[model samples]
Target: MTLLPDLVSRAAGRHAQRDAVVMGSRRLSYAALEQASNRLARSLIAHGVRRGDRVALWLPKSPEAVVALYGVMKAGAAYVPVDPGAPPARMAWIARNCEVAGLVTCADRIARVDEAFAGRPPMRALWVTDDAADAPRVAGLPTVTWPALAAESAERPAVPAVDADLAYVLYTSGSTGDPKGVMLSHRNALAFVEWAGDTFGVTSEDRLANHAPFHFDLSTFDLFAAARAGAALYPVPPRLFAFPAAVAKSWCEQRLTVWYATPSTLVLFLTRGGLASLDLSALRVLLFAGEVFPVKYLRELMRLAPHARFANLYGPTETNVCTWYDVKGIPADDAPLPIGVPCCNDEALVLDESLKPVPGGGAGELWVRGATVMQGYWGDPGRTALALQSIEVAPGISDRAYRTGDIVRRRADGDLEFLGRRDHQVKTRGYRVELGEIETTLHRHPAVDEAVVVAIPDEEITNRLKAVVVTRPGAAVSEADLRQHCAATLPRYMVPEAIEFRAALPRTSSGKVDRRALQELSS
Candidate 1:
């Protein structure tokens, strides 16, 4: 398939009456999904959203959100998924940065939308997915209710797009106190999706669980792979994420055949979700990524779900699932797992700082080159150039590769073992965060003079953030006060877990904040 929407069209032709998306009491058939998305695409075109434009989806995980994703693609525009739980200011910054042509949201978020736009909406039109009557009108913004959107023709709109065209833009935390957009094309996503579908043997009989949010790259596998195999997709409700018991109950009730999520989530289920008491015999394939899985927890999970085959997927958002390892068994001791060999027609190189290939059994930065690699950071050529470089694979030949900041070492068996990151970027709760971004936010507070954020290693969630602060003289700021300030401009995951007031921060020889010293103290 050249375009992403083709997956849905192909499935609709074969499985017209089959369930495509399922939530609580709601089921949308493949045929219905195709028709609904076609109508939504037509509506977007009528509202001046042209090809190559960007449309933002600002709602939570729901059936409508799924439809909106395909509709944006069908409209020949790239979709930008905004985190529903992000603060208004952060959401506004994303919308402004992407310069979205249209926005899809619900009525309950209208107030927050108003706060984000501040009476000056940037988009050309707004599409309300539910409860339109309760939505308040915003000045200078044309709102389209569901009834109006549904009235459009269900026939597919005539638009031209190619496999190399931009499909979606995912915003990730930037080291400069802003978010950076990663540009991914239809080809980039399909490279990984096709491989995953074939490797996992997904079929119409399989039921896949979409546990990650749409903004995350993991969701691409959940959505496209299911469509490719004509399988049923179950988007676990966002509300159930906080309650591990509810998530476990849903897993048993749904009888999910394929499950893909971060190790942090699985750890939560293993500890508090009551996994031992549940029956997961239907689970055939279980995949984990985003962070290293604690061997102790993984071993216990393997014992509980013996019927499922486990795999470790590793890569950054720029290169989706470059390398993976199938878990046959864990060692008796607490040894770090290998990320495995490259997949999806990708090439892996362990290169030193000078871009020379590292010798066997040596550690170096991981670099990936393949169709799965992203186009680059949207509208930021400098940062893009820094991450993506043209490496000389041979004496007279060079290939473009993305330099992953992660360090890995080649084992004797040819499997690559993952080490820590070379930079300050860390993953917590399956979300990538730049430590400098949190420190920048803290520095903005009037009560903080000097601040440094450190990542404390934890087996459960990968890492927990702790902020060491040297407050300004005469300023009486509490931890709660600083946390509340961060909540206004950053996501919850970016907020520091612990805050300590110090008289002065330790400094290194170069007069830089001593992060290592702070981390030792926090740990």
Candidate 2:
């Protein structure tokens, strides 16, 4: 298929009556999904959503959300997914930054949506996917309810788009205190989806677990790969994450054949999900990514599900899964696992500060060149230029590649061993976060004079964030107050796990904040 919607169209023809998406006993057949998405697309088009316009999805993960995303793309517009649980201010900032022409949200979030767009140029349209009868209408905005949306024509829209056209934009934390949107085209997503479907040998008989949130890149594989292979997709409920046992039960009940999620979630399952007592023989392929998988926990998981094969997928949002490693046997030790070779028709290069390839066995930043790399950061040319640069692939031959900013060392066996990040960016619970972003938020508090955010290494979640702050003289701010302040503007995951008030932040002789010392203190 040349475009993303083509996946759904082909699947509908091939597996018309087969289950496509399943959420809490609600199952949508391939034909039904196609028709629903087509109707939604027509609704969007009728509301003035034109080709190339940006549409934002701010709903929780549900069948309606899935339909909304496909419908947005079918309307010849790229869908920007906003974290449904994020603060209204943050979501509004993203909406404004991308200049979204339309939004798809639920009744519960309409108030916050109004708050977000209060004084800004109103969106062209707002779609409420559920509880429309009780949803309060906002002034000066055209709102469509589920009933009205469903009444639209089910025939596919005739809007023209190409494989290179934008498909989606995912926002990631930025060092400058604002989230940046990573633009991916249909070809970019198809490259990775095609690879994942082939690598795992997904088929209509396969039941894939969609554990990652739609906003996360990992969900791309879960969503598109299933559609590509005509497999059934089961979206794990977000609330089940707090109860690992419930998560395990859900997988067992679904008889999922393929499972993909972050290491932190797997660790939770291993420790408390009661996997030892469950029947997981149906799970055939297991994939983990977004952070280093502690070898101990992974090894235990391997023991628990001996029939399943596990692979570690690695890449930044800029390049969706550039490399991956298959666990052939039980890990020998607690040493970090290699990220393995490049996948999805991608090339990986270990380069030094000068952009020259690093000699074998030496550590350097990882650079990737391939079809799967993102188009660019949405609306930010300077940052895009800095991330995507022309680097030498061969003698007198240079190609555009994304600088991953992740440090790695080539193993003696040719595999790339992941070292760590080259910057203050860190992964916590599979979410990429910039320490400077949190520090900037902390500084915004009137009582804070100086603030720094440090990551403390943890085996379970990769790293736990801790905030150290120096208050302005006589300014009384408790840790809870600072945390509440952060919660107002940041996602729950980005909020510092622990906050400390100090008389003064330790500084280096050169007058810079001693981050290293702060990390040591936090640890």
Candidate 3:
């Protein structure tokens, strides 16, 4: 009953005549969306996708992307939505790592898809939703166009799935140079969906503005919560993401009742997006996550959108939004906004190194326990075991808990206030970035001998990555050359904002690269 497709099926039946998805000039009714997905589901089944098989989606945010999502789930396959903007090398790694059964994308992206799958194990099929006329051919792989894929009957497939079955596998940056898939089950997604639907009082009348990319965990709430409440999902187009003013205009034109994005996105709108001039009388709930919102920009947003209720959500991809804070009012510019309390069916615990609860509300690592915690990292049991530890909650009573590497302190009001990270992982514009991954990419360039990536927090760039590189003796390379090398392998956000060349890296007594000393150099 708690399966992911169940949510879609129920919403389509209940709101059959209502708008289910709105993208630019296109609007899809629930019945139409359901039937289209059913056809796609049948297509996936005919193409040999089975229960638990990974179906990768490397498409942009559109009605077709939404259809592919539900269709793959309806076929009892776990959907893996890769950022369409991902580098070919990264995409290839994910495709091989997951052994994806099929990929749903457009004709325009076929060349990149071919490049990603060039030397890897073959993916079964490629389903192009837009066109197939100019689509590049990949050896031994059949290309199915939209019209041909829809030739299959629109009858629902009887794929066996349950609450425990995986709904999606989202790959995040790994410290070990590659990406790791965080396996989330239907039950895991439902925990946040149900909680968010109730918490925000969402209904069919409300329209949701989805700003986060499909691959991001934040988009989970935007997609599922809307379906849970039988509401309409309005996606922010990829190009509009860059032009903050256009984003503000779209928000007003769409009359979005609920808006959710990273704090940086919100800041962009307030500072330069013409948000002050917009007629946003329809906006209600405004939610932010992925990175800490500076109190200054937050206050300005509050002042402008005084009618909207603001909230802050906190969690890692391993746990989908365990805690949330509904802003009561604007606090002082210097005050820290707490991550707040646990969501429904979830518990947040502050623990020390020994796994015991932290004493006297002191700073400690945050551990999440409950339904929202992920099943585990896909195909990496050793790392999974390290992250998911068993903690005795009540003497003999124990539960599986995710050790979030965030340092936080429980406040006098019983809310958890985030202090900082315990590791090199930092959030850049709401995207979780592993500094080690950037360092690994820098090492790929033939010029450098040693590299260390550090986060330099700023008011404008948020948490930008700064790379300190030591080139091999007599191997000359400019900062631009190194940047181009990183750009070829990494996503735009993961690329270092600034690079510093040095004769040699600072070291500690143990003869290891001293990141702390390097931090001082950056400051």
Number of the top-ranking candidate, with lDDT as the measure: 1
RMSD of 1: 1.1
TM-score, every prediction: 0.98, 0.98, 0.98
Q: Tens digit of lDDT per residue, candidate 3, span 1-523?
A: 6776777788888999888898888999888888889999998888899999999898888899999999999999999999888887777778778889998988888888777666453578888988677667776788888888658887788887888999999999899888899999999999888998899899989999988999999898888888887899998887777888998899898899998899988888988888988888999999998888888888888888898899999999999899999998766556868999999599999999998899888999999999999999989999899999999987788999999999999988888999998988988888899999999989888888999998887775578789999999889999999998998878889999899998888999999999999888897
Tens-place lDDT per residue, model 1, 1-523, is 4799999999999998999999878999999999989999999999999999999998889999999999999999999998888888888888888999999998888878887898988899998898597679767888887777768999989999999998999999999888899999999999999999999999999999999999999999999999998999999888887888898889888899999999999999999899999999999999999999999999999999997899999899999899999999996677978999999888998999999999978999999999899999988999999999999877997999999999999999999999888989999988999999999999999989998899999989999999989999999999999999999999899999899899999889999888888888888
Reference-based lDDT, residue 36, model 1: 88
In terms of lDDT, model 1 sits at 0.92
C-alpha lDDT values of all predictions: 0.92, 0.91, 0.88
Q: Which segments of model 3 are wrong by more than 4 Å?
A: 119-121
Per-residue error (Å), model 3, residue 129 = 1.2
lDDT-superior candidate, 2 or 3: 2
Question: Which segments of candidate 1 are over 4 A away from where they belong?
Answer: none
Model 3 shows how many backbone clashes? 0
- TM-score of model 3 (CA atoms): 0.98
Residues 1-523 of candidate 2: C-alpha lDDT, one tens digit per residue: 3889889989999999999999887999999999999999999999999999999998788999889999999999999998888998888888889999998999988888887678454578899998588787767888898888668888889999999999999999999888999999999999999998999899999999998888899999988999998899999876675788998889987799999999999898878898878899899999999999888888888988888988999999999999999888755666788999999999999999999899868999999999899999999999999999999899988889999999999989888998888889999998999999999999899999999999999988999999988999989999999999999989889999999888998999999999999988888
